[model samples]
Target chain A: MSGYFKRKEKWHKKYLQKDATLPMEIKVEEVSPQMSVIIPQGEIDMGSSGELRDVLHKTTKNKVQTIIVSLEDAGHIDSSGIATLIEALKKVEAYSGELRVVINTKKIFNVFKIANLDMVFKIYESTQDAKNA
Target chain B: MQKTLNESVYIQLSSNPKMATFLRNNVHKSCSMVGFDEEQTDMIVLAVDEAFTNIIRHGYKMDFTQRIDIRLKIHENKYFKIILQDNAPIIDKNCIKARCLDEIRPGGLGVHFLYTIMDYVEYTTINERNALIMTKHLPKKSRTKRLSSVNQQLLQTLLDIGRYVHQILDLDTLLNVIVNEVKNLIQCESVSVLLEDRETKELFFHTVLDENKEVANKLRGLRFDSNKGFAGKAFASGEPLLVRDVEHNPEHYNKIDEDTGAKTSSLLYSPLKVQKRVIGLLGVKNKISGSFSEQDVEAVTAIASTVALSIDNAYAHETLQQTIPDLSETNRIRKEIESARLMHQATLPQALPSIPQLDISAVCQPATEVGGDYYDFIRLNENNHAFAVGDVSGHGLEAGMMVSMARSCLYTQVNFSNSISDVMTAMNRMVCGSIDKNLMMTFLFAVFNTQTKVMAFANAGHPYPCYYQAKSDTWQLIKDGEFPLGIHEEFQYSTHRIQFDKGDFVVLYSDGILEASDENKEHYGLERLLKLLGSKKWMNAQEIQLAMLRDVRNFCESLFHDDLTILVIHFL
Candidate 1:
């Protein structure tokens, strides 16, 4: 049983190392005059969460009224990534703007649910639903 | 290159960029004549070029008309010495600060390169002229046996620094002292310490000490990827790096210099390792007189090891300080739990009522300080007696409180209702009305009639009571029950009837007994329990109860994960 736990821990460390090696890409697109969409295309972990936070802060600083974060291409996000999103939400709210998230991955969505943040933030099934909101 | 042992060469040159090559060649030839190896000769030539460049660019401020006098001497057939005297304005030794190596740039490495190649460096003012003297010891035939006075001094300095570092516990003070002492000990232009963030694998400049405050501040808070720069390389490889020329070194990262406008020339970097794991990097850059030598590397590496240990101690002290309040709070909570456990123990039945031809025994052990499992016996009259065993959903103060509440309610309702089913229904209604919706409990209530030799019981989601017949060596389980109490207000339960014969016994238990798991997660299931009880049917009620508990204790091996309660009644 101890051996099993040791093997499990080793696999977990390897998985985290693999996740850290993947390059993080963020794309910003202007959907309308008031709305902009930011899509992150990799794991949003400690190594890359700073980039997302910076991009979000910049987008809100530009006075965009509505910001949508699309996690369609994001396979995994840790607590640091969640904290960055929370910071972005607070930043947009201070400017009387709004922030919405669109997530389709069940695993990522379950994280939000478990933290009870799914109730706190506006979540949508697709980009169309978020844009409509 | 064939020169006499006492030969001395004196030259005067204008402070110009073109003079550096001529000076380098002259120094190379002088060193070759002294029997220096190729590598040693190249290092000597580089140090000479760097010194001339500094005199021309920084000391003279690029004034080509200024004349600098250089003297090369072979001293006592064992030391090669160079003396450079400049007629320029007297240089303030205090004002000469080496730029941070972390601030990788193009210009500041001159003085550092000079200290790397020479054994002794000094600047002095004599007759109103600024003179810089540098010396290199000749390589002896028996190198290993010659422990020079310089090595002894270095060792004493390292010991002093180690003692000083160990005496301090504050992280900031300790780091500041380390960087300053290292710069002074190694005679380097600047010293900077970079500590690793264990989680991110990033190195951040913790302290940058230089004579120039502006240069030092510029490199403060500078961060580098652990796999990027020379310092990072040292940390990654857990080794010391001696870079004689930073400009030609491939591992040098120049981004910091570009941002801060500071320069770096030579670098001596050592990894701060604890338990063979790299935790930080310590770098000394730009020796004031000559490039860094093997002795400088050895001294700085020793200091780096001490710095690692001191940092570890400081961190441990900080964590202990932070946890002091938390530890006190934990102690207070533990005391409160202990009191609650004692109160719950007080509520247990102190002595069982003795009746003719009946044996009754019960035992309950909580998994924590306070338990949710409760057992009570109420005497209704001379011929009637009521008994109950209940398990709340959770353990702790709230569950223990619920157990007391159930005991009070059962004591009052069992006397009013003659049937076990009516008493259970009433207790369920009271619990559903008073308790939180999320909380519920499993309960069993039974009443024995002394004259009729019969037992009537009602179970609400509790484990069924087991019956043993000594005449046939048979076992029977009574499992007919309703949903657990406090879950539904209108749920109905039917009374279970069993006629007791002589030498027959009934065992009432909570789920804790059957669900006790071992380290391998295998539970003590019902089959093992039934077999144990069947074999012990011939024993008295108290003995049978002890025998079953002992079996459970042996099987689980002190790995009880829940409350275990057992009530055994024998009829004669």
Candidate 2:
């Protein structure tokens, strides 16, 4: 199956309210003591990348063995968004932990590929796949 | 009439992060109105959002109180133009380049997105304000619709009228040319204009052109209350009105017809307005063929606007001609200041003096206005050399005079004084006697004895110099200072001594370095300066100074607000 098949549009509709005032919605789920999954829904550009960075920083500080940044519901991602993931990878490496990202579409995945970050982080098609890895 | 390729939407918002959402919403709606597809609209909105955020972040330096003006219009009927203007300090356009993508920096992507998505992107400074203009080509369907038959002619005619606005200056001549053009275009019997007398609050016949010279002669110099006639109703309401049958219209006043004794079956009335102020009334009477149509009203309203602006400009020109004598004196003073600035820069040493044991390099960059930052090297004797860097408190000719006064006194006093403290004390007395107490200068003076490998330095309320230790590979600040010069005459100054090792260095700079701030309003702090200095220990004196200057320039893309002076001395 194509990676686009795992898009979380309905999932975003179920969890996130249509709020124009808020830049984006970030939800963190602790699957276990050693792992945490952070789902960010909305366009991640300079305006909202700071929020994602803060969440990633906090999750890494907790000493989680593995952290997954799932952009399955994200509509778009810009350079700042990619930079935030790179920063998280750096912090995770300092503690000898694992950092993974879940991108559902080739369009957004190409953004990471263009930045040459796809080779740096372990990417998956779904949150379940990221967790399994 | 303002001739434009397409209608424009203007928006002004406070420079705040939260306002980005509001800006995006408006941009989406405007894109839709211009018939952009979903994907294209999203891309345009993304580009516009990045631009707005960049303005709030970089242009205004996160200053929430400042304002940003945005104008969205169609250019040449085929491209959508976005003009964003801000009142912040002028940006250095050369620094607006997108960083190399390999760098992976967080802040440089906004400019990249702007260039990638928009067809044409330009950064400019207009009227001392920074403007970012971007344009994207419209889709095919919208382009054809914009080039319809009727609006094309209207656009051409308006363009011609716009040319008149810039070409003609004499009020009577401009009015005559516009009136004749309006009469020919509308095919009307006569076109008349009534200007408002601001002092009397009345309207008088400013321009009356008609085929019947008798009627035109009678209408001249006719004055009436601004709210008494058909023209007054349109002028007061600031709306264009077309009365098809003026004989039956209740709002129509027959005063003009009675005065000129001309039959008026129909007429179009438009308020002549400029910059949102109703300046006069434009009347096109007796449409020669049939009654006036809605299209005629629109055409008359457009011409009236252009006419009003031309008249206002002519009036301003008349006033400006009366004030031409006063402007020449202002220009003369400006020239004198420029020459003084050149002379001020000439006083500083053009070349560094060579010493056997020391490598020294110094630079002084004045602000846009003439400033009082100076540095000098005086070889007192063969073995002993004296160096000094100082900045007066303010800018302009007064500060320049203070610098020269301090320099002359220093050269004379350093030769006669016995110690560094004695030199400072004598300079302090001279400053106290020469300048005002409010204006003081921060100065640093040092003397190096090449044979003993020791230096004596004193600070007069100046910033502490950064010192690098070659052995420990650590940096420290040589700190201790009393009042600045011109503050106290009898104050006893103290001198400090430091021993230099081979490969040791000291960097002296003005406060402009420490206080230079980035777009985030974060200063190029002392810690960063010390870290940078410590990292570049392998570089020579000139290279280190260039690196420090380049770092500060990168930190603050705009010009430095104050004078910047840096002097580096390396022991080898």
Candidate 3:
């Protein structure tokens, strides 16, 4: 019963306040019984990097088999946000699980290209493509 | 016609946009009375209206109460002159520029139209007022009609050069543009600018331009004494020289032609002056069509004065750019010193320990951002309290770090041993083995017992602690100690015991107090400190400490060059 309410609260926060000046918003959806998808929107800067780090920490602690991060509406991501993503990816790889990223905007994708993180992460063009992989 | 030529009209009005239309209507009527056609009258009216708008908007910032005086005069049936005067902030003529026509901007066309229609337009500030003088030559019906376009071209060239000078700030780029523009305008074979070195009083060719690039390269950077050559003579005398035949001139420096392999037939040299002081020389050599004329000399003189003022501005900008980095480096070092000071302050004891039958007060003040002086009070057990004061050899970050290390080692040693001599021996070994070889610290440690009124003290090359007996009213200094820590680890330290009664106390200090100097370079020596402490022996521990610190401050006039630390303990 607690898991059902936690899922409901996550969906409620994702739809409301779409035009607010929040750093980010996260939505969790169970793709299968063993895997889940985390979609984040808006800019991921220094102010919101800590929230992303905590979500990744809790997901890996529960020993999920695969995690997918969809950044379809993310407009900008700075160096601190990129560093948090890299740390989370390393933690998932240490256990036998996998982590994938889905980026749609050129501005968000170019940040990874500039830092040469495009070669390290398993990236997909869309969330649909990531789910199939 | 003679009555019209000598007529003068003066209009005084406030700076308002509505007044511009009235002013233009009067100018149109005046031009028509002098037999100007409809198109010519319209152009003159437009130019006059724009000038008034500029004086009101830019000069006065649209303040309508300022007065503007417009004077119109027709001279000798040949020229029409207009002078507009206003009291406003002086405009920097160098920075006034017309926009590029290729960019397709809407504004900045007023100055361009004035330069195109008028034969001469000059702006000057005299006695805190701006005067803009404009003159247009009246068109004639003969050969002078053919020369009108040529005069127009000459004015256009000078305006173009003036605009270019204000655009480029790089010295090399500016010199290249000036030399090329002057050569084309005067139709001379070559043009060169020579700059005067303030230190040596010599002139050197800064930029040279000729039809042949090889000859120009050879003449660049050539130097001569300012009183020797024709160019030098023009600079030294602060006058312009037009030499038609160089062979007959005694001031011609023939060595330049000998080196560059170029012939010099005619030369015109003008001194470049700014505010009555000559800065350099501008020379035009060997006209292509004819010899240098009086008109050529006049034109080159006007160009020289404008170039001199522009060069001064470029030098000032370069100097300011060079000093920015030096200012930032000083700011960086100041912030680092502030950080080190905060770190040193965090290592000090927050509050003094309050034990039974003892009153204690300790204070440390650093002269700079960070200092090497330190003191601490620790509770060894329920019956004993340990106190220490130390002075490191130097100041700043390294000294502050050493003081912190000494503090941690002292606390660790006191927890394990109750004997003062044993604690000093262990602290000396730790400092000698771990710290830098050049660093040294002088420390004095003592443990006081509240039940027996017994104090065991060990001194290590520090200033002696002062012992005062209230019953006898005498002061005694304890100076018997071993070497300072970090110097010799194997040396044996001796512990001395003293019994204290009620109203007896001891004062421990660093060398900063004894070495503080007054304006006369007199040290506040031990004799003065002993006398002050003896007089205040009957006071409480905190009162005696404050009195001693105040005395030292008063003697030195509050000028402290070293870190001062003092600790006072009283037995009740």
Candidate 2 residue B422 C-alpha distance from true site, Å: 1.4
Model 2 segments beyond 4 Å from truth?
A1-133, B1-128, B135-327, B559-562
CA-only RMSD, every prediction: 34.8, 27.8, 38.5
* Superposed model 3: Cα runs more than 4 Å off: A1-133, B1-327
Clashes in model 2: which pairs? B1-B306
lDDT of each: 0.71, 0.75, 0.70
List the candidate numbers ranked by TM-score, top first. 2, 3, 1
Which one wins on TM-score? 2
Per-residue accuracy of model 1 over A2-81 as CA lDDT, tens digit each: 33234334433522232222346799889987999999986565446678988988898998999999998785554456
Question: Residue A32's C-alpha lDDT in candidate 2?
Answer: 96
B326-387 per-residue lDDT for model 1 (tens digits): 24566567657755765675566654667766888777667546888988888877887888
Summarize candidate 3's per-residue lDDT along B308-406 as a digit string, tens digits: 645643433333223333345655675567557656755666556768888776667665558888888888888988888888888988888888888
Q: Quote model 2's TM-score for chain B.
A: 0.47
- Cα misplacement distance, residue B88 of candidate 1 (Å): 69
Docking class of 3: incorrect
Models sorted by DockQ, best on top: 2, 1, 3
**Candidate number that wins on lDDT, 1 or 2:** 2
In candidate 1 chain A, what residue range of length 10 has the lowest lDDT sum? Answer: A14-23
TM-score of each: 0.35, 0.39, 0.36
